[model samples]
Target: MMQFCYDDLDQWCHHCVHFVFVDEGLIAFSSFVLHLCAIKA
Candidate 1:
């Protein structure tokens, strides 16, 4: 039972890390797009 709990916690942490990585990528992409628009204007 304890092992199962630990496995679940590990999965959760992996998902949290993945989410943060994707979120950061999105923020960077949006900022880059905005920068391009600024340059065009």
Candidate 2:
């Protein structure tokens, strides 16, 4: 997983319109998608 700066997360949240910080650390959507793709492959 990648580490994002606060500003990067802020920008994403602004553009995403609906975002929440979950305690489980499952917030990195792009990485999560890539991980899933890798798993499928």
Candidate 3:
């Protein structure tokens, strides 16, 4: 489950940066996921 979420995040980050003009929020979101998963672990 954890690895799946991280993989999804990686794909989403690339897609988000590629498609969206606003990356700051996406980057922040990714970081949030990192912290979230770390805490979960």
| Steric collisions counted per model | 0, 0, 0
TM-score of 2: 0.33
For candidate 1, lDDT tens digit of each residue in 13-36?
433223323566566654554454
Highest lDDT, which number?
Answer: 3
lDDT of 1: 0.44
**How many clashing pairs in candidate 1?**
0
Once fitted onto the true fold, the runs of candidate 2 whose alpha carbons sit more than 4 angstroms away are 1-27
- Where model 3 places Cα greater than 4 Å from the true spot, the runs are 1-25
List pairs with backbone clashes in candidate 1: none
Give the least accurate 10-residue stretch of model 1, judged by summed lDDT. Answer: 12-21
Cα error, residue 15 of model 2, in Å, equals 20
lDDT tens per residue, model 2, 1-41: 22342346444443431233443464576455445445655
The RMSD (Cα, Å) of candidate 1 is 14.4
Tell me how candidate 3 scores on lDDT.
Answer: 0.50
